[model samples]
Target: MTRTRWKFARIIGIIAASILLYLLLGVKTYLYKASVFLPNAHPNEVWEYVADFSNMKYLNPTIEDFEIIEENGNYNHWQYTVQYKEHLSHWPYLPNYAKARFSIKPDESKSKFFIKSFHTTCLINDFLCLNSESEFSFTRGYSSHGVHCDEEIAYECPAIFARFCEREVKYQRDAIMLNLKRRFQ
Candidate 1:
């Protein structure tokens, strides 16, 4: 082939390779943090609901079952069922059962509670999901009459398609927080 034609082909090949690599191996994991604040809400009263991880059902309607394997003061090892109604959402969560160790720490003022999760299993058998954790805090917002809840999710998965969990997580979190706001205030 001519020199110019050969160079043009090489450049095209490189571009194609880069695109393929990005599609196959890129964005396998994601970290997201979200928060909601409600005015005219009681902080301690809100903490009662937020401190217990089992209370997730109050926020996430998709949770069909929640079982506590072990429990102590402000700490629990639990498993819960997640229902993915639509086909698009069900594929990634093959097993649909999740297990995690969650804990809560409340400040002396009782205005803030920190909830942390560790050793979380996204799928029943730990299939496609590699690692995941949700860190959440419920506190008093700018005013004593207001309540604030913050959540951070650090998730990792080997499959590129598994990253879809990020959007789902954000949506569910927002839904639950809004539910809490309406319920309390």
Candidate 2:
């Protein structure tokens, strides 16, 4: 009985230490980027849909819902919810909703527009919750081929777990952009 109890205590201690280490070492912020071009669309045409935060519902599949809480000029404060995957649907991992403030600027030539999210309440996901920023630039007049789009994400997470999920994040971004292209072209 004494030996069995000692083994159990040691196991528990190890688990506790592992958890502590993870909490300390797994926290970080990362910047990610992606870009794509729309074959037959122009930046002006795309801006109408993207400049409005609520339109993300049509562009992004993961965006279950989007509401414009407030708006002032080219700035918007919005509340949105992402579709929760099965594994992330439990306990604190499940988020009620996300909030973000975004802005849009038309270029000097009016041939392009730049949209950026200055702040967001949710980072990548609930498990890796932190502050995040996103930037998107839509440019046209490059020989009339199409509009070129570039996007960048700066995410600050308390856990590095999201690093492993980069592929999913990339796919999600691309899918949204693809949807935008389809909508415009």
Candidate 3:
């Protein structure tokens, strides 16, 4: 086949795959919840570390850029764009130029921290997901050994993108937790 023909064939294949993926995904939203525990870390210390959104790019290098839209002491509303160089853009976890927002606030007693994130836009050279919301709670507790810290997150994403988005989101969360655990350890 000619080079032009090969390019055309590849484009067609991509379109067909996208259509098939959309069909399989349907129109719906999915919620994903996860929990992770950090050892040797106080709740307040962990909360302070996670709440600092600016430093997240270092924690998760996939973040291309991070900005603080609003801030109030430990409580902050922030936005960041992610850039991933995965083998396939359709992998969901590696959306090119994905944008998201995150913020959290702790309760009066400073025992529990509440977090909310809106993954509003995902672009693969084009607009993709409309919206995905994730709410999280971080708590500092005690165990027989010492400080016991736990964090839970509830995530909601469009079904069409969930296959890809969920995996990427989980990877990001897991990476963050692993780093945090290592720090406290």
Candidate 4:
């Protein structure tokens, strides 16, 4: 009985120490990038859809919902819920929403647009992410008949959560790009 109790106490102590160490871990940064070409999409129309923050629900599968906190001439401030796309057994600590300020600004030539989302919240995803920023550029096809889109994301999280965050981001991006293609072309 004494030996069994000692073993149990040691196990509990180890688990506690592991949890404490994880909580103390510093943030790990990640960069994600993806590009897509829409042959049947016109640059103007694509810009209209991609630049609108209100259309996030249609474009991103991970966005369960979004609320516009403020809107200016060329900028939008919104809060969005990021829920698990797949069935998660149980995760109560994950943040359900994040706040961000985004801008859709046209270039001097008016043929390209810079779209960005700057996370205003702590980017707290229950230790999954500490900070995040997204940028997208939509340019008129050089000589083709469509639009060229480039997307990049820079985020920081604990190293243990990096893989999961990266994978989730990629999955969401793939879905978003596919939806954009379907809607425009």
Winning candidate number (TM-score): 4
Q: Compared with the true structure, what per-residue lDDT tens digits does model 3 show for residues 45-147?
A: 7666765665576556456665554444434333334323322223536445445566666673757766666665545665554566766666765552323
Worst 10 residues of 3 by lDDT: 81-90
Ranking the candidates on lDDT from highest down gives: 4, 2, 1, 3
Clashing pairs in 1: none
Models 1 onward score TM values of 0.69, 0.69, 0.63, 0.72
Could you tell me how far off, in angstroms, the CA of residue 21 lies in candidate 1 after the best superposition?
Answer: 8.2
Predictions in order: lDDT: 0.65, 0.66, 0.59, 0.68
For all candidates, what are the clash counts?
Answer: 0, 0, 2, 0
Per-residue alpha-carbon lDDT of candidate 4 for residues 1-185, written as tens digits (9 for 90 to 100): 69999999999999999888877565667889988889887666777687766577788755655666666673323223332222211343444456677777777366776777776333345433356788988888888578998899987766666666677678777878888888877
Runs in model 3 lying further than 4 Å from the true structure: 1-25, 72-95, 142-162
Ranking by TM-score: 4, 2, 1, 3
User: What TM-score should be assigned to candidate 4?
Assistant: 0.72
Model 3 lDDT, residue 117, Cα: 66
- Minimum summed lDDT over a 10-residue window in model 1 is located at 79-88
Compared with the true structure, the alpha-carbon lDDT of candidate 1 equals 0.65
- For candidate 2, write residues 1-185 as lDDT tens digits: 69999999999999999999888667577888877788788776776578765677676656565566666663223323333222221233543346676677777465777777755444345443456688888888469668888899887655646654465457667877788877867
Best by lDDT: 4
Candidate 1 lDDT, 58-137, residue by residue in tens: 67766666666666653222223232221113344444556567666677466677767764444545454455778887
Task: Sum up the clashes in candidate 3.
Answer: 2
